[model samples]
Target: MTSHQPPLWRRAVAEMLGTALLVCIVVGSGIAAQQLSPNDVGLQLLQNSTATVLGLTVLILMFGPVSGAHFNPVVSLADWLLGRRSRTGLTLAELGTYVVAQMVGGIGGSVLANAMFEVGTSISAKDRATAGTLLGEVVATAGLVLLIFSLAATRRGILAAPAVGAYIGAAYWFTSSTSFANPAVTVGRIFSDTFAGIAPSSVPGFVLAQLVGAAVGVGLLVLLFPAASRMADDVVVPHPSQKDGS
Candidate 1:
């Protein structure tokens, strides 16, 4: 391991904490938006999207140095896939660990958000999955994957914080499904019945769509970048001062 690389366990912890805070922001903002703009759905969406945009950017910058700030499973998977070339991002084994950590963090974040809002871990009753939404998921996920991977692969990881946050915020308006691009976020939203929530029944479809979107994204990344070896390190938005010491 390189002297600058943080250990996998530490990275996983960062992922868990970062993801938990991220979901907290997403759900909490949605609840706040709904309350603040009770009569105007458009206003509520604007509020929610703005909060998410700002929150995501801050979170990435805050945690990127620790765990690449990869709170999404698909991103970690993509890292592993692309990392294979130069052995930069994540190794195959690290992929599973990251996914599991992200999932646990996502769910925990949802529950925490619910608790904060007096919802008490309720299952979301908002069954929003539809044919059109699935397509939106594909598009949203594909675009997200493409943007993130492209930046990292091109050694532009520093831009990922604002770039990713901006893309997601934009997707919230441009896409029909409001851009639940991450499967972890999709699953996490199931814990609340608020404006940001999705029904349990919709989980499978959304997850499937996200996976498909990720695949599409990977393909586009390969087509455009064509070289994963160009990545800067073995992680997305690689760590700061930490050294592997191994």
Candidate 2:
């Protein structure tokens, strides 16, 4: 029997649900962090990092089987550019659908956070607009996208799923931005009146930086592993096709 390929609609829906799960975990963790340890700055920050790492690990494992678990737009973009995406990859219509789903899912996470945590009562950070903070956003997001591309997107020979968690977890401390790598998560965090929230004005810069970083990551992958990119283009027929059953 031939293996079945999933329809485009199924992939799009999977993307939507995976993106939503990512946002929900990040935002919900922020709310919980506040409720559990309201006044401890260090603890709150650590909680943010820890929760994000753990949530990502679970989500990656859970949804990877369905849609490759790409909740970040940068990952999708890099995959398209690098040619690891399935078939001819996503058509314009499908790409649009995925983007819309991501945005809507982000908004849904924000709205859920608001309802669950009494949003208006919480105090948002006033320092979100500072130059240092914006710089932090840029660096953090870039690091995340780069990691995704290098780890699993273009270079299939490089590390895969489970290692993605360790890569991100370690980056959180080494990178100045604590690795907020995902745009959807960043957008959702804006609605929460908590430490994790980014100022609305900062979103554009953060996302742009992330895209740049993803491209850079792919470029680096090509530079370091020329054979991989070459392999990316050549169609390798399945080995089992040579079996007597054929």
How do all models score by TM-score? 0.94, 0.78
Give model 2's TM-score versus the native structure.
Answer: 0.78
Off by over 4 Å in 1: 232-235, 240-246
For 122-229, candidate 1 gives per-residue lDDT tens digits of 899998899999999999999998888788767777898899999999999999999998988888899888999999999899999998998999999888888754
**Model 2 Cα shift for residue 138 (angstroms):** 5.0
lDDT (C-alpha) at residue 172 in model 1: 95
Which digits, one per residue and each the tens of the lDDT, describe model 2 over residues 1-246?
A: 563444556656767777777677666777788779999966876786687778777767665654566677666665555664434334456556666777777767666766776665333453344455445555655555455545443544224455566667676677655666667766666766666676676677666666666666666666765443333211111011111211
Candidate whose TM-score is highest = 1
Error of 2 at 29 (Å): 1.1
